[model samples]
Target chain A: MSEGSQGLLLAGVGGQGVILASMIVADALMRAGHDVKQSEVHGMAQRGGSVFSHIRWGERVDSPLVPLGSAEVLAAFEWAEAVRWVEYVRDGGAVVADVRTIVPPGACNDHRSWLRRYPGIDGELFDSRHLKTRLIDATATAEELGNVRAANSVILGTVAAFIDIDNKHWEAAIAHLVPKGTEEINLAAFRIGRDVAEARVPQTAPDPEGFSGPHQIEINHVWCKGCDICSRVCPEYCLAVDVDGKLTIIDAEACTGCKLCEALCPDFAIEISAPREPAVVGNQAAADGSTL
Target chain B: MTDVKTYLREWAMPHVLCPGCAHGIVLRSFLNAVDQLQIDQDKLAMVAGIGCSSRLVGYVDFCTLHGTHGRAPAFATGLKLARPDLKVVVVTGDGDALAIGGNHLIHAARRNIDITVLLLNNSIYGMTGGQAAPTTPEGALASTTPAGNTEPNFDACKLLMGAGASFVARVLAANPMDMTKVMADGLDHPGFSFIEVISDCPEYFGRYNKVGGGAEMLTWMSVRDEGVAGPLAEKRFVNHIPIESVPSGMETGVLQREIRPVYAGVRKVEDHES
Candidate 1:
């Protein structure tokens, strides 16, 4: 590592202005009489994918990439991204993160439980790393300033507090880089963000009630005409008709309570009963809880 | 959520519909909509005329009235006017609503009364031994039209929309969730809500047309969906039915919704001003 060089990382969802914020940081660093190099990945920006940028500044900056556990600070625009990029920050470094959550498409695999695969706001996770964490609702602050799009400026303002750069440099870069006519709100958002307090971290949400286990599938043999409709419509392939023209439960435990078979059955012979216990206990809990 | 079975008359289990019939699915979706709306069973009324679709009213635990053939809409209109507090729903088959009771159905829609009409169009009179119904696609084989009927089929949703129905929608039995959603919207509508459910009769229509069983019929119905309704210029399948007479694609979703004064009863002089 260089004697006087410092690295910073910014992480967020694709459309959260991660690249623009990185550019502003680099510009401000240059204005502070330091050589700066910045690199970013926004290939999946339009698809709501992860976006991140690395900025390094010093007397003579070389590599724009911030090595693992070497960054001085980490700025994250979303909650999940904060946890994702927190490892890059060195011990005792600072983390500026917005408490906003943006759930990706892949996390919506289990529609039956209706529980999002998202991490809760837990400060203990950062405490384990011995890092300073500042969680703020930048979007709400920017929204109060009249435009929600100025949220990135608010985040940049908090990030500015951690860097040893002058306020004039940040305001100049923000005013010069942001879209025309949005300068006032963005500057106001930055000013408010500089003095913003730590937001109240909400407690971990409890598992939703009523969905305890696999739904109970009951079939009335007398009413079921073995028409093959219910068996074919079952997404989980839980029901199947035998050669003798009788409905049977082939995979009872796989039922997700989608109710497709129950709703499509022609004879009203199938009924799905909700599970009596909570499905969130033990091994069946969402993977996000244990991974974080 | 309350069990949908609670809304049904358990003794009426094993409905009289033929094997592989889609009416049962429509019934289940309707019950789901009713359950979602949380309408009190005692305060809801199910009116039906004589047909396979009409038989659905008899199985529900709500206040039901099985009227004469093709007169379900007339009965529903009277019941709604007499008891404005009750949520009245008329379940009728294509043959019952579009043919036998077509006049009453059109008049009820024209008047914009507060009632929901679910016209289950199976394209044949399944209860009457597979006779050709008014909604039977041209060139389709029915017991009465073995030589392929020369008469054209009726687009039930278009007819209702043209008759000034405040809310009009068409849903396929293949998509039960979408069917339930549209049914819920119709039930919540204020005046003259008409929903045409494209159901299948595996024993009758499917067998006569060689359209396979219930599963195949459902797939075929799904393929006919012309996407959600939009502006007339943006519609891909503008013509109701293609010239090939094979029952071309049709728009499925809320086709029209208008806020019109509902016909409650004889309006007073001051009522017109309001």
Candidate 2:
């Protein structure tokens, strides 16, 4: 909402819904009035490799990259990744992390002997140095409320508390970002994550100049075969991919009317247009939901 | 002497081709051959069937016909018969030349009609979204066959030679100079000359089969082309050494050349007099 930008880092191993979680947070930031710039590590994403999303939001964000140790928030989908990306967090930045620990294979040949030799705990995560940390059992919370897949949503909600945005905006983001039928449980997971993180102090406020405008551009999801070509070509780094590998808008406000994405699309799936008055949701049925 | 650009109907262009398509190179080679020969443009008649390569007939400044699907040879036969003085050429894609039009192609070669056939082989039916064609390589993925095509492909050059074509050559789109030379030679050949161009359809075929787009496909073709594999080895090894063997790679040069009796539906005056 101010002159300066906000940097957030999202890190996780592949298949943990890290990209989708970042998409939700980034979309909500744009709706709350900032020009969001989002970028992700797409390589080695299918092999359970380290993945990170760089999200920056402001009136006029110049770059999609977050310089090392400059991020205000680092949301880790797993405790091991929490320790892995802890160095990226600014000294005063907040970290909302999943308490679940996933040890890489071969790290400990025998879990029983390793558990006895070194019990896993917060302090075991080599000194976090001065960065503020709030570890949450988001997986337990999500599974208690019916779907372990919503663990990503719970972690996102936990991170939502450290950032300055209304609960309603987060609700709207979940509705627009998540698939159709799973909205109810995912929202429940979000609320649980927020309640779990209520003890922390929010370091920033929603941008007073944040984009409270309509979404521009319509994608004929029917033509989108989950190709990353459009997302890679967006001039303002506004397009992002969802869990299904389809393109989802991250910062519609950052669009400069450049039709490169539309023109380069092999399927002609993207169409740039003026924002509608009603702020209609995008082609929500995924590509299968399009007019095949 | 008209150049290739001059031969092109400027108003009809620019020719629609997707990024990374080999069809452009093949089309350019054909135009370059026509340009090099300084052939009579007014007397040139080109017939094409329905497909991406068939669209070539619409852009060339010749007496061109483009509506028939897999029946370009049938149309070319009629054109050559009616105006025996015209230098007629038929262009078709793998599907058009070897599938629905297979019979027409074999018959055209059998009769040894005085015409040239340019078979643009991209391996799959590209215009219809990467369907498996008769020329599609075995085990390659197609839209209709998501689990890899189980059917084998046709070797157009061998098939044409078996059907008694007077001139048969196989060329690659990557080697434009050689392709043009073969094209010009085919045009100059007296009886049915069939040139099979190993071209690429990157949008559909390349995408579905995981083949690197046009450039990579071209690079592969260039490397796969082991030049002049058949004739010389046959002369040196088989006839001289009394050995029986065949070359391993795709034979590149002209496979066959012979003088054949042209079918005109009637005996010539010399034959009648004799």
- TM (B chain), model 2: 0.87
User: DockQ for model 1?
Assistant: 0.38
Model 1 residue A209 lDDT score: 38
lDDT of 2 at A282: 30
Candidate 2 has a TM-score of: 0.45
Top-DockQ structure, candidate number? 1
Q: Score the docking of each candidate (DockQ).
A: 0.38, 0.02
How big is the positional error of residue B172 in model 1, measured in Å on the Cα after superposition? 1.9
- The TM-score leader among the candidates is 1
lDDT of 1 by residue, A1-292 (tens): 6657999999999888899999999998999899999999987878889999999999997789999998999999988899888889999899999877776655533434334455666677789888887888898888888888889989888888899988999999988899999899989998888888887544443343334568889999999999998887676788899999999999877787878788788888888877656565333232333322
